[model samples]
Target: MILHILDEEKFLKKAIQIFNDILPKDNVYLIGVNNKKSEIFHERIQLDNMFYVETGSSRYKRVFQEYAERADIIFFHNLYKSYKLNLYSLIPNNTKNVWYLWGAEIYGLNPRINNILPLTQKAYNSNLPLLKLLRKRVLSKIKKNYEWHLFKKILTNKIDYVLTNISEDIDLLESYIPNGTSKGWFTYFSFSEQNFEDRIVLKRNNILIGNSSSETNNHIDTFELIRGKDISQRKVYVPLSYGDEEYKRVVISEGRRLFKDKMVPLTEFLHLDEYNSIINGCSILIMNHKRQQAFNTIMMAIAAGCKVFLRDENTIYSCLKREGFLVFSVQKDFGGEDAMNPLTEKEMLRNISLCQQLYKYSTVKSRIKQQILSILDEQDKT
Candidate 1:
C-alpha cells in the first residue's frame, strides 16, 4: 500500500482521487490540522479509504508507524512536527518516498516565511512596533530555525523525489535538498476533457484583486497600482476570507481607503457556489503575490475567461506564457486602457482549450502512474 500523509486542504480531495485512480491501493492519514476538526473536514472533503488521529491520543503512533513502515511508498504533502509519528527515518529504507513540495513547506524554510510586510507601507508594523519586533527578532527566527531542522533532517536526508508545479522552485531549493532527490512535476488541479463552447469576454466590469489576506498577496500594492486608473466603470472585489487576521483587517482598511465604496472586501470564507459566483461575475483578476500562491483561484479565473494579471516575478507567469496561455503581467501590463481589454475570441478559445489539454486529469493520472510504476520497477530490479 502507498501511504499518503496529507494536509487538511481542498486539493487533497483531488490528490486522493488521482492517487486512488492510479495506485493499486493507498492509505491516507491527514495531519497538519486540529484533531477536533477532523471528522467534519473529512465529511467536507468527502474522504474515504483514509483516517486521521486525534491530537492527544497514542493512536497516531500505532497507526502512522504501522502503515508507514509497511507501505511500499510514502507520500508527504506537508512537513510538520507530526514527524514524531511519521518520521522519514522510521520508514523502510526501500520504501519509495515522494515529497510534494507544497508552497508552505518550502516557504517555511525561508526566514521571512514569504512575509510581504514591506508593501503594506508600514501601516501594519507601525501600529504594532513591539509586536513586529517580537515577530522579526524572536518568533520568525524560532519558526525558521525549527523548519530548517526539518529541512536538513528529513527533506535533505533521505527523500527520493521532490514534486512541485514549477521547476524554478526546485531550482530555488537546489542547495537545500540532497543531490540525489529527483524532480517530478504536479499541479493541484486536473482539467476536464469535455468540449465546451463559450466565448471569452472581458468588458472591464467586476474586478478581483488578490485571493487572500496573506501578506504575500501584497494586496496594498495591488490596490495602489489600480488606484490611479479610472475604476468608475469597475467594482473591485478582494478575497480576504481566510489568512492572517490582522493582515486581513489591514488589507480591508487600505482597500476601502483607496477604492472607497467600489471595493468589496470578502471577510468571511465563501462557500464554493458563492465564491464561484464572484469568480464568474468578474472580468478582470489581479494577483500581486511575490510567490506562487492562490493558484487555484488564478487557474479558475483563467478557465472562466477572466483577464488575469500576475507579477512577472512569479514563475507561473512564465510557465503559463510558455504554455501559450493568454496571461498578463501586473507591473508592465496592469494599468491604462490596454490592461482592461480581454483576449480575442480566438485567443480566449485557445487559452481555455490549452488549459484543459495541458492539465487534463487523464494526462496527469498517466504521468503520476508512470512515475510511481518507475519507482516500483526499480524496487523490483533491486
Candidate 2:
C-alpha cells in the first residue's frame, strides 16, 4: 500500500484528486499533518480517504508507528520538519521513502551567503525598525540552519526517490543526496496544455510583474527596471496572494507610486479558472525571481500565448530556451524590441505550438503517472 504524508492545504486538494483518480482507494492511504494554517483546510476538505492528525499528538505518533510497517511506500510532500511530527521516528527503514521536491524545499536548502542576513539589501531593504530587522535576521538564520541539519540527518540519507524536473534542483539533489537515492523528473502540477485551435495571441503591451510578495521575486528590482517607462495607459498586474505581508504592503506602495491608477495588486486569493481568465487579457509577463517561483503561473502565461520575460540567469529561462520555447531575457533589451510591440500571427502560432508540446495537461498527467509506475517498477526489481 502507498501512504502519503501531506500538509493540509487547499492547493494540495487538486494534487490529492489526481492521486485518488490514479490509485485505488484501498491501495492508497492519505495522512495530513496539522499545522498553523491547516485547520481551515481540514474543515473544508472532508474526505473518507484522508485522516487528519496533529503531529505533536501521541495518537499521531502511534498512527505513524502502525503505518510505518503496513505501508509499502511512504511519500513525503516536502521535508519540512514542523512541530506537527517527528520525521525520523515516522519514516521506516523497511519501506521505500519518496520525497516530492516542491520548489521551496529545494530553493531554501542552499540559500546564498549574501541572502543569509535578512537585513541584507538583497532580501529585505524595507523601512522596518533596526532592532526588529536584526532580530528577524538572527531568527531566520537559526531556523534555516536547523532545518538544514534535520534535512541532512532525516531525509538526505534515507529517501529512495526524489521527484523533480528543474535542472538546478537536480544538481542540488545530486550534490546532497546519498548513493542509491534515485531521481526522477516529475514536476508538481506545473504543466498545463494549450488548445492550438482558435488561439488568440495577446499583444505584448500590458505588463504583469512578479508572482508573489516573496523576496525572491525581486519586486524592487523589477519595479526599478520599468520605472522610467511611460505606462500611463497600460495596466500592470502584480499577484501578491500569499507571502510576506510587509513585503506585499511595500510592493503595493511602490507600485502605486510608480504607476498610480494603472497599478493593480492582486492581494486576494483567486481560483485557478478566474486567474487564468485574467491571464488571457495580459500580454507581457515579467518575472524577476532570483529563484524558481511562479513556475505554474509562468507556464499558464506561455500557454495563453503571452510573451514571457525572465532573467537568463534563471534555470527556467535556460531550460525553456533549450526546449525551443521563445522566451526573452529581461537583462537584454530583446534586440531593442519594445514591450508594447504586438506579435505577428506566425510568432503567436509558434508560441501556441510550443506551449501545447511542453505544458499540456494531458502530457503532464501521463508523465506523472509514468514516473510513479517507474519508481514502483524499480522497487519491484530491487
Candidate 3:
C-alpha cells in the first residue's frame, strides 16, 4: 500500500485525483494533516481510503499507526512542516519514503548558488513575534541535538526518492539523504490543471502582478517599481487569494493608492476557469518572486501570450531561459515610463510553442503516470 501524507492545500485535491487515475484505488491511501481543511477535502473527494485526523484526539495516532503498518511506501507531499517530524519518527526503518519538493520548503532552507542568508536573516530580525522566533530557535537546537540528528539521519537515509524538477532542490535533498541514494526526476509541474491553449494574439494592455500575498514576491518593491510608470491607462491585477492576510491587505491598500481604478485585487477565491480568464485578459505578467514560486502562473501567462517578467535572481529564470523561453528579467527592466508593452507576434508564437512543449496537460499527465508507475515497479523489485 502507498500511504500519501499531505498538508492543507486545495491543489492536493486534484493531485490526489491524478494519483487515483494512475494507481490502483485499493493500494493508495491519503491522510490529510490539517483537521478543518482535511474535512473540507474529504467532503470534496469522499474517498474510502482517505482519512483526516481529529485534532488533539487520542484516535489520531491509532488511525495513522494502523495505516502505517499496511503501507509499503510513505509519501510526504512536501518537506517543510515540523508537524510531521514526530509522525515520521513512527514509520518503521524498512518503509520506503518519497518527498515532493515544493520550492519554498527546499529553497527557503537551501538557497543553492544564491547568497541569500544575510537577506533572510535581516528579514527574520524585523518585527516578528519574539516568542515565535525563540520557539523556532529552541526547536532548531533540539533538531540539531546529537541524538535527534542521529534519529533524523536514520529516517532521511530511508528516503528512496526525492521528486523535483529543479536541479538545486535535488542537490539540497541529496545533502540530507545518506549515500545520496535519493533519485531525482524531471517531474512536470504536477499541480497545474489548466487547459493550455495558444491564446489569440491581441493588443495586450493590462499587467498581472505577484502570484500571491507572500513576502517572497517582493510585492512592495515591484509595486514601487511600476507605481510612477506612464501606464495609468493599463490595469494591474494582483492575485491575493492565498497567503498572509495582513500582507494582502497592505498590498490591496498600496495597489489602490498607486493605480486607483486600474488596480484589481483578487481578494476572493476564484474558480479555475475564472482565474484563467483573468490570465487571458492580461498583456504583461510580472512575478517578482525571489525563489521559484508562481512558476505555474508564469507558464500559463506565457502560453496565453503575455509578456512575463520575473527577477533574474530567481532560479527558474535561468532554467526557463535555457529552455528557450522569451522571459524578461526585472533586474534590467527595473522601471520604465512605458511599462506596459504588448507581445509581438514572433514572441507570442515562441512562448506558445515553449509553453505547450513544457507544460501542456497531456505531456505532464503522461510523464507523471510513467514516473509513478516506474516507482511502483521499483518497489515491487524490493
Candidate 4:
C-alpha cells in the first residue's frame, strides 16, 4: 500500500486521477485536499482527487495517520511543509519515503533570484505586494531556522529517494540537505498522454511568452528581451490565469506598456481544446523560467512544431538539448539578429517526430509504471 502526502495544486488532481487509473486498484491517492475548502474546487464534492474528506483537520490527521501506518511507502509531494512535516518522528523507519521534487519546493524554498534578468527581477521586487513581501520574508527565515533544525535529519535518515527527471534539482537540493536522498527520474511530464490531433502544427509567427504571472516566468523581462525584435506580425500571448495576482497586474501593465497592441494577457483559464488551438497557431514558445517550470507547455510547443527557447541557467535546458530537443538558450540564442525566426522545416519535422515517439501515451504509461514498480520491487526485495 502507498500514501501520498500531497500539496493542493490543480494539476496534481488530474495527474493523480490518471495515476490511480494506471496503477493497480485504488492504492495511489491524491491526499490532503478538502474539496470544499480548496481554492481550485469549491463545494463538498466527492471528486476522485482525495480519498478521505473531513471538515475537521483533526479528523484529517487521524485519517492520514491511519493510511500512513498501512503504507509500505510514503511520498512527500513537493516538500511544501518539509521541515514542518515531522518526517522523522511520524513514519515508520522501515517505510520508504520519496520526495517527488516539484521545482517550486526547491526554488520556492531557496530561490536564485539573481539568475533572473535584471528588468524582470526589478519589476517583480518593485511590484510585489507588501503582504506577500512580508510573507516571503517570514518563509525565508523559516527556511534558515529549519537548516539548523530537523531538515538534515529528515532528509538523510527518513527520505530514501528523490524522484524527479532533473538531477540538477537533486544537486541544488543537496546544497540544502547534503548527502541526503538518492535521486531518480520520474516522467511526470512525458508527452505520452497527449492526443495526436491536438498538435496542429503550422508555419506560425505568433509567440507565447511564459506559462504564468509568477515572477519566475519573467514576463516583464521577456517584454524587454523582445523589445525591438522584428515581431510586428507576431502577437505575444502570456498566460496569467494563476500565480500571484499582484504580479499578474505588474506583468500585464509592463507587457502592454512595451508591446501595446501585440500583448495579449490570458487572464482567464481556457479549455484544453482552446489552449491547443492557440499553441497550434504559434510558431514560437519562449519560456524564460530560471528553473524547470512550464514543462507541459514547452513539450506541447515541441509537438506543435514551435521553436522553444529556455534560459541556459535552467538545468532542463541542457537536459532537453542532450535528450535531442531543439531547445535554444535565451541568454545566448535570443537577443540576436535572427531571434524571431521559427524552427526550419527539417528541425520542426524532427521535433514533431521525436515528440510523438518519445512522449506518446504508451511511452508515458510505461515510464510511470516502471518508476512505480521499481520502488515496489525494492520493497519486495527488502
Candidate 5:
C-alpha cells in the first residue's frame, strides 16, 4: 500500500490524479487532513481506493504509525513541524519516505528566528503596515526559533528523497543537507492540470490580483504604488477566513478610496473550477513580496497563460529569470542620486510581453506531474 498525506484540496486532487495513473489500480490509499466532504468529493469521481483521515496534529502519530505498518512507502505532502515531530522520526527506517517541500515549511517567513522583529521593522519602514501586522501575528502564533529547530530535526531523518516545486528551493535545501547533490533534491515546476473550459469572457478591462492572506505583506506595497499612480482598473480577489476580516477590510477600503469605481473585491472561497475561470480571465497577476519561500500561485497563473508582474528582487523572480521565463519586472528603489531614474513604461511593457510569450513555451504543469511520478517510481524501485 502507498500512503499519501494531503493537506490542501488542490494538491489532493492533483496528487490523486497522478497516483492513480502510476500506482497499482487498488494499491493507493489517500489520507487527507481535510474535512470528510472534500475527501468524499475527491474519491467519488476518480480515486476509488481513497481513505479519509481526519485533520489534526495530535492524532497524526497514531494514524501514521498504523498506516506505515502496512504501507510499502509513505509520502508527506510538505515538511510541516507537526509531521516532523510525529511522523518523520517515528516512521520505520526501512520504508521509503519522501518529503515534498512546498512554501512555508522550507523557506520560512523570515531569514532566521532572531530576524523576525527586524524584518517587521523593515516592513514598517517600507510603508507596508498591513504586511507588518500580518507578520507580527504569524510570529506571535508560531515561534520562529522552535520551528527552525524542528525543521533541522526533520532534515536529519533518513528521508529517501526530497521533491520541490521550485528550482530555487533545491538550493535552499542544499544549505541544510550534507551531501547537497541534485540526486536527493528534485526540481519540478508548479502546475494544476484540472482542465476548465475557459469561463473568462473578459467582461471588464480590469487587472485581477489574487492572493491568499499569507502573502499580504509582500503585496501591500505594490498595491499602494499602483494606487498612487491613479491606476483605476484593479480588482483584488482573496479567499476569506474569519481571521482575515480586519486585514481584508483594510485592503479593500484602501483600494476603493484610491481607485474609486475601478476596484472590486472578491472574498469567498471559490471552487476549483470557478477559481480557475476567474484567474484565467484576469489581465495580469501581480506579486510584490520581498522574499517568497515559493510562488506557486504566480506559476499557476503563468501556466494558465496569464501575464504576470512581480518585483524583480524576489527569489522566485530571480529563479524564473535564470530559467529564461520572461514573466516579471524588477522595481528599482530610487533614493539619493539615483532617485531621478526609474523603470520606463516601455521597458516594463516589453518585459510583460516577453512573459506572455514565455508562458506559451513553458511546460511547468507537465514538469510538476513528472516530478511527482518520478518520486513514486523511485519508491517502487527501492
Candidate 6:
C-alpha cells in the first residue's frame, strides 16, 4: 500500500516505526512536509521506499493533490491549526486519510477560555471554594471540547480511521466518533538500544526538566511560579527551536536563573540520535499545563524509568491514573488563600515513591505496539 505521511518535528520517527513494523510486507512510502535534509536522512536509515517534499504552506495544497492521487492512504501526525489538514480536502475521495490524534489536537486551547470565563465569573459571585471550582470548570471544558472537536471532525471529514497510542485515548475518541475504531499505535520516542540498560537504573538526584515546543509555555509559566518553593532540586534544560532567542531570554529573565553550565539550547534542529541522548539523560519529567496534553517527553521519561509530574485532573492524567500510574498534581493553592497547602517537600517524596511503583509494572511500549499491530492486521483484511 502507498502511504504518504506529513508532520513536523520528531513525531515522524514514531510514525515511520509503526508503518514499517505493522506493514513490513506491504509497499510503503514515507513523506515529510518540511526539512528535506532530515527527511532524506530518515529515508537513508530505513529500507522501505521513502520520499521528502519540502513544500511551504502556499504550495502544500497543489503538491498534496498530486501525491494524494498516487497514494492509497494519507497519514497526518501532530498536525494542528498551522499545517492545516484541510489540505486533505484536496485528496481523492477514494484515498483513505488517517489522522493520528496524539494529544493536544484532541484537547483544544489551554485554559479553554470559552469554558473557564463563565466559571470564573460564577466563582467571583458565589462563596464556593474558588480553586476547586476552577479545577472542575477547567476539566469539564477539556472533556466537553475534546468530545465536540473530535466528533465534529470525524463526522465532517472523509477520514477513514483515527489512531492513537493509548487505549484510553481510543475510549475518549470513540465517545465522540462512535463509529471510529481503535488503531493501536505507540511512539518510538524512547531511549536507543545503546542506552536502554543505563536508563533502567533509576537515579534520585537532581530532577531534569526540558521542553522543546511552544505549546508548553503554560508549563514553563507554572514552573516559574513555583520556582525555589522547596520542591525537589531542579535543573531546567530547554532546546530552543530556531529564532526562539526571544522566548529563551524572557524565560531566563523572569524565571529561576538556570545555571549557565546546566543550560542546553538548540539554535538549530538536531538528529534523532542526539535528541534521544539528551532526553534519556534526564531524571524526572515535569509538565504543568492547565490542560494535560499527551506529551512525548513524559513518555520518554517513563521509558527511561524517570518520574513524571503533570496536573492531576486533566483527561490525560485521569487516563494515566486508571492505568495505575501516579504521575500528576493538581494546583489547589497558588496564593495566600490556601497558604496552609501541603508542603512541596512531602509531595515530591510521595511522587517519587509512586514513580518507583509505576516503573515496576508498566510496560507501555509493549502494550502500545501490540495494539498497533492488531489494528493494521484488521485494516488489511478490510
C-alpha TM-scores of all predictions: 0.89, 0.88, 0.82, 0.87, 0.71, 0.63
Q: Which candidate is the best by TM-score?
A: 1
Clashes of each: 0, 4, 0, 4, 1, 2
Model 5 Cα lDDT, one tens digit per residue, 40-114? 323343446665556654565667677777776677677663544445556787666777776566556233422
Worst 10 residues of 2 by lDDT: 111-120
Candidates 4 and 5 compared by TM-score, better number: 4
lDDT of 6 by residue, 1-382 (tens): 5455555345555556655555665434444456633423243344436554454555566566666677655665544443444454465666556666665554553223321223223323253356755765687567556555544554356666666545565666465446543254544444333334433444443344445434344434444444534444444555555323444544444344434444444445677667656655555555555444535556555555555656654555666667565454535433333322322433444443444444322343555446544545555675
Clash number for model 4? 4
**lDDT of each residue in 76-169, candidate 2, tens digit only:** 7777655422567567777778877775655675444232223225435566567868876788778777776677666556788877667666
Higher-scoring candidate on TM-score, 1 or 5: 1
Off by over 4 Å in 4: 26-30, 34-37, 41-49, 52-56, 81-88, 111-115, 128-153, 192-200
Ranking by lDDT: 4, 1, 2, 3, 5, 6
In terms of lDDT, which candidate is strongest? 4
Tens-digit lDDT track of model 4 for 77-176 = 7664543355456667777787787776666545333445678878877767788777766976776466445655666777888887777777877776
Model 4 pairs in collision: 191-359, 192-359, 192-360, 192-361
lDDT of 3 by residue, 69-117 (tens): 7777777776555555556556666666777767655444432323232
Please, what is the whole-model Cα lDDT of each candidate in the order they appear? 0.72, 0.69, 0.67, 0.73, 0.53, 0.50
Error of 4 at 18 (Å): 4.3
Ranking by TM-score: 1, 2, 4, 3, 5, 6
**Which residues of candidate 6, in runs, are more than 4 Å off?**
25-32, 35-48, 56-63, 70-72, 81-84, 108-155, 167-186, 189-204, 213-215, 230-234, 242-245, 256-283, 292-294, 330-382
Residue-by-residue lDDT tens digits, candidate 1, 116-184:
636674666664558675786687788677767756667656678888767776776774554568888
RMSD of each: 2.9, 3.1, 4.3, 3.3, 6.4, 9.0
